[model samples]
Target: MKWPILQAFPSFSPRYLRPFLRLCAQQSALIIGKKLHALILTTGLSATQTSFLLNTLLHFYASCGDILSAQKLFVEIPHSCKDIADWTALMSSFSRQNRPHDALRLFAQMLENSIQIDDVPMVCLFSVCAWLRDVGVGSQGHGCVVKMGFEGKVKVSNAMMDMYGKCGMVREMRRVFDEMKEKNVVSWTVVLDGVLKWEGVRSGRLLFDEMPERNEVAWTIMVVGCVGSGFSKDGFLLLSEMVFHWGFKLNHITLCSLLSACAQSGDVVMGRWVHVYGLKLMGTEMDIMVGTATLDMYAKCGRVDTAVKVFECMPRRNVVSWNAMLSGLAMHGRGRVALDMFPRMIEEVKPDDLTFIAVLSACSHSGLIDQGSYYFDNLESLYGITPKIDHYACMVDLLGRAGRLEDAQTLINQMPIPPNEVVLGSLLGSCNSHGKLQLAERVLQKLTEMNPLNTEYHILLSNMYALAGKRQKANSLRKVLTTKGIRKVPGMSSIHVDGHVHQFSAGDKSHPRTQEIYLMLDDMVRRLRSAGYIPNPASQVFSGSDGIEDDAMDLEEKEQALFSHSEKLAVCFGLLSTKPGTPLYIFKNLRICQDCHAALKIVSKIYYREIVVRDRNRFHCFKQGSCSCCDFW
Candidate 1:
């Protein structure tokens, strides 16, 4: 196959070298690339071959993420003689460097020079548009694809679908996907991710169920969606089915998502198993993402020591690693330790906005008002990160908890953006705690005006009126709510026993064990009373009544009504079903009513056991006649 010319010179001409170098660059072979460069220099073809060889080198460097070298070589290529591939290569390099704006500028320059658009440039532009969420620019690129008769190309169409999805145009993404003559796994994964990120887990699950063929990516996407959307149980359930029933091999991605689900659900036992399996499967060379997920899992599962061990064992640490450890410490009420890690984080990884948010959250939970305030105020100055709405909300919570209601209000008013429902809700709760009736009323009024359909604000206002001894006002509010068909939300509680969840609502007698629960509650009350516990009648004034009735029958009815709150029944059920010295864990869907809180304190002392109850807003660990919330929540 040897040619006569190659036999004569024993080598190809520099003119022939161009195509060879271009091919080597396209294939991304460093060995062939260096050999080509040396051959050009040995032939004394520097002046003649510099431009083409440099362009080839630039392409190789850009593809390998050596952007500095690529940029230096690109600067040597004269703009007047640059080809389409050179322009495309530079745009792609900038895009990979996270400089989308620079890529767009280069695209504009290429267009001005009348360079014909190709699939590579179109994909690069679409990628930039996706990153910037610039739908208009993306549509313009689509038009170019159509005009160039490249609309039938699968790769180009996939890029378009990805652009629409990342820009949150789910309907458009589906339209493009539906129009495709054939669909691949990538097409399905991208659209599914869009649905999960924008619509929710239910939508993603629906799409997944309808999919004819499933791959590992499809399973991972669904699992991640479930965990992210607060349906961690569903995620774990799916993971179990995939492994045992579907016979899918678990990979790093699968294990990572499952670990996140366990962390979020606070399933420490399952998390430990996942950790063991991950070590056996991945062989301890865990990526940063998997390490972070495991650390977060341990922290949320109330095992800060385990989280610390994972963090220490990680081969490399990033900002997310530090944030995970700090967040775990904060969740476990080890705020001092979380704060102590801040300096180390800055020294190691240079904390970012999310890092600050985690640290600030720890401070807020620990009631370190001054520390939280300091970090919040200096976020922009110290880290060049502006405080977002969540940060402001945490600040409001911190100030509100410290009983500095006026200061919190002032801060809310001074915020660059208007306060959202969370900020207002935090303020209202603080007012209720401090008995600041007037301020509570004002905040409620504003909240109702902003969101008239919100039932929670109406309930809060009604309770505020009752606490202020304004029965007429409370009654009027209740009447309005009744007319609007807005009944108060029923209080419900659940306790896990023998791996099954048992739920109860206020005044509920539907459980099969109802009679036994009632009997147990009665006996517990007697034991608590004998231990010098007195009923806190102050919480019985639902209608602002003194609860001391003129008639004995009316007093008896009031006492009966107070005993039927859902938390009380759940506590009773826990006492009867669980053994002695076992800590009872109850989850309530609302704030623990004042009566329930006092009763539980007495129950804890009388039974000589600790009861941990997590309510809507805070945790109440009642032991020895005291609560961790200090009777404040």
Candidate 2:
């Protein structure tokens, strides 16, 4: 009664083998894959089975990035036998490999082959169209989906939304979203994120508010939207509301968004709090994104040491992590360290434009002119990255800072694209620094012609004229400004005192503590005089009539005006209010005036205190009768 040998052979189903082979492919278990292939052949099912088994095998190979194997297996399948799943899988594989053109070609071939299009193919095609920004291809995919009656499929609808959004066609995305009768959390997220990415944060917030149901993704999208639109404070506010008010748990994405917000806002305290809480929630196994955001937060908040610590502790580091550390070093004036990290980054993870920019900026800050030039040249020679306007501007700044004005101008002249305001402005700034009046005049002419509305260019040009004793030209420029009703931007200073920011401007006496501030300033001046500080009468501009006598009077009036300059008054206020040893930190809207600079050096030595002033250009750390800039700025 024993069964025949043919009957004893176990009847196998491809479905049971399909998932197993997929797992093997995903894990890159080549040995296992060969073993399974051999098993399929020995089982005598390879030839007898439908194309389903062969297509599954082909998909497995494609998913594993074995494109050659996939192509060979695809060839083995009869041309007339290609199905929708086979075509979709191959196209998706190509898309994943960043061969979008190949993917599109395959899609076109599938359509020509008259394969029955399905939801999967529609999603894949839509994604390819989006990546290529082919509005026409996207429309064709949409038409196919409509013909197939798959418009309601969530996956297909989401792909269409993404396509429209990326093409800057928010209206089309909205139409697709409106037609979807049943939207899951992912559906809403897709539409909301698309709107946010395309239209901006305000529109994203509007969509967020309109949503009836909210999820972690919804909140995260809104937080990112705010961050993208430069509303970091608003993003942080939204994050706080989500956690404390809404009782939502924070995820890695949420932490990244919140940390990014803190970085942009320079809110160190809030950033630290978020970092601590994130660690408590996610533990020490932080993802690269969260860790990078944390590093960026510390760096931007003037805690570069903290940023370095976070970076060093990261279990895994990507290009962004390296860039963050490099930027932190640059920001802290540790340009050598930044430069040191550059080669290491190149060896490890190839430098990008941003990385080079960071390195160039560090070189500019630390005056590493040779290294800066080498990197600048190498950006094109080695990396094949033609310098953009920003790169050129950085180089101009580097050479200009090093007193290579003519070389800087030559670089500008050689720029492939016409120099924009930033490039020319940088050159003009260098000219002003080096007292190259003629060169500055030429640069200013080009700048004013291109940017008539730019007030800073006019101010700088006038200052240059005044510095060179071109009194009539300066006077004429002033008259022009007056006629145009364009007032000089008032100099403003901010001092952090008693956990609040106190703002002051030139001739500002509106503060409630104005009388106390002035009295303190007067006393400080006496002390400064006793410490051998002498007033410089030449640090002023004449603003009266055209005659020599009136000009002399105007010069005297200008010197008196310097005494009331915002930075001087802010420093005096700090001296009066703060403890004698505490370092004073002041932020200024403009470069520190010459008189204020001289006065701060005397004030620092007289009071035996350190003063750190951040002006429009760079940090000036004054201590012991000298500034960090060495009076070069």
Candidate 3:
């Protein structure tokens, strides 16, 4: 398709070239742009005309993601003709390309050339600073903002706050917020977000209450932040206020954020409500973001069948959408189904890094070693994705879980990049599972060398010792930990009931209905015993069990420790509170113990109730005396 101007190139006016160049840049018509550049050179335009056109030409290349061309053209532009826009455009291109160091270098050159800084360039500089997380450079930019009298600009001020917040300079961010003479919704929201990151949900809520105006973004931030930090009740209340009280319409991002929060908190009631609301708001057509988020919420909340329905109904799908479905299946221990979906995914949208991570994890969870090995071996050759640490971690986990400890170790040693905590941790977990005490010790030594202050690794090894009947070694380790003032992080579990989340620790008595909870637990134990539920001896020695002493324990004491584990307490409370046949959703901060897992299997059958537990690793759905994982997990 030839443009009319190209047919009559000789008669083309310089003014005509400006709009054509502008259009080419707008649409990123690179070939058309190259022809126009040739025409400009051949037409022999005057110096001033060419100079003006050069700025637009430079921007065209930048807009098309041709950083090299943009840089070359920037160099070609005469110093006298170059302005702040040209400098800013090139710097922005570098920033967009994730070359923040290059952007900083250009900024320095612009400063050397005596180019005046404006709000736009300063904002770009702050973004680069944020990406670099360089507070020294960011502080210098703040000084420049003050020096240049651009401090009053809202966008500039917001960028500064964002940079500071991302760099963990929360106090500086707050100071900037306090000193601002004028504040808008974004201003309040930025400060609120920073406060949430540094000071936790309670402080964020306090700041949110004080805001003069609340928009959807501010509400979303507060809601997601609260739910993410284990404050589900407050998060739900905030959502209610945002909708019913303020009558604010929820956008897809807001809906997605809320759904993700619901997933994190395992609040199925809220998740279902959000799904229905999204359906109504967006009509029958489900876009990718909302659909994927809704699917993830269901999957995380232990409803993979519903997630599959949502996945099938989505009007559009991307790699992320496919990954969500695959991950959902993986979470439910449906590895073959997840693998089957992978072929179908690549038939439509191309798979990415996260997609492989989900697939490999599925294989690992289901003990599909052959399939996992094939995919991992061909990741680079077949998919053009160089295996990252996460991929290696998944492979390690796969081999380790299958009792191929030597093979897993060999793979880790052969990895190009060093194994991260997750990779080594996977191997450590596998070693413990297989009772390879010597191998577990070696892995623990490597883990401790990598992160000496990581208490979880120490506790894992201690639990192994206790389980192996080496009580002296376990007691010594516990004493050393206590002497060093490093207390083990207690396990916590929460269940959503009647729109309120009830949190419990082992032996927790904090609930108002504590007496009833204990009585219900006593009944559960009796019923479980009648149903032939014996506490796992391994579960008894888990190091973080609350109220358990470091001293050697008798068999009766060990069994006592097992009964009061956090998930059991939460389950007992759920049973006591909810009606008969009501499904219970439990979210735990740690993995479900062996005793809880076995007991919950019996509890589901005896009580005629379905129990879904989402622990740190994956989802477990118990029904009719069987678990969704089929005892693999």
Once fitted onto the true fold, the runs of candidate 3 whose alpha carbons sit more than 4 angstroms away are 4-50, 60-72, 75-83, 94-119, 128-150, 230-234, 543-549, 552-554
Quick one: best TM-score, which candidate? 3
Q: Model 1 lDDT vs. the true structure?
A: 0.77
TM-score of each: 0.67, 0.63, 0.90
Per-residue accuracy of model 2 over 1-633 as CA lDDT, tens digit each: 332432423555676777778888789776667666666767667564746678878878888877777878888888766677778878898988889999889888887877777799788888888888888889888888888899879999998988888787888888999999988777778888888887888878887888888998789888767755546567768878988999999878778877886665445545787899877876778888999999998876556678989988888888888988886676556788888777777777877788877888888878889999998998888998878888999899899988999899889889999999988998888887788888888888898899777667766767668768887887687667668886666778877565345778876799889998888777876787787766654454421111111244555465556666788788888988898898787767677777678889888887888887766665677888887666654
| Higher-scoring candidate on lDDT, 2 or 3 | 3
The per-prediction CA RMSD against the true structure, in angstroms, equals 8.2, 8.5, 3.2
Candidate 3 local Cα displacement, residue 206, angstroms? 3.4
Among all windows of 10 consecutive residues in model 3, the one with the lowest summed lDDT is 542-551
Which segments of model 2 are wrong by more than 4 Å?
1-242, 487-490, 495-499, 532-557, 569-580, 602-609
lDDT (0 to 1) per candidate = 0.77, 0.77, 0.88
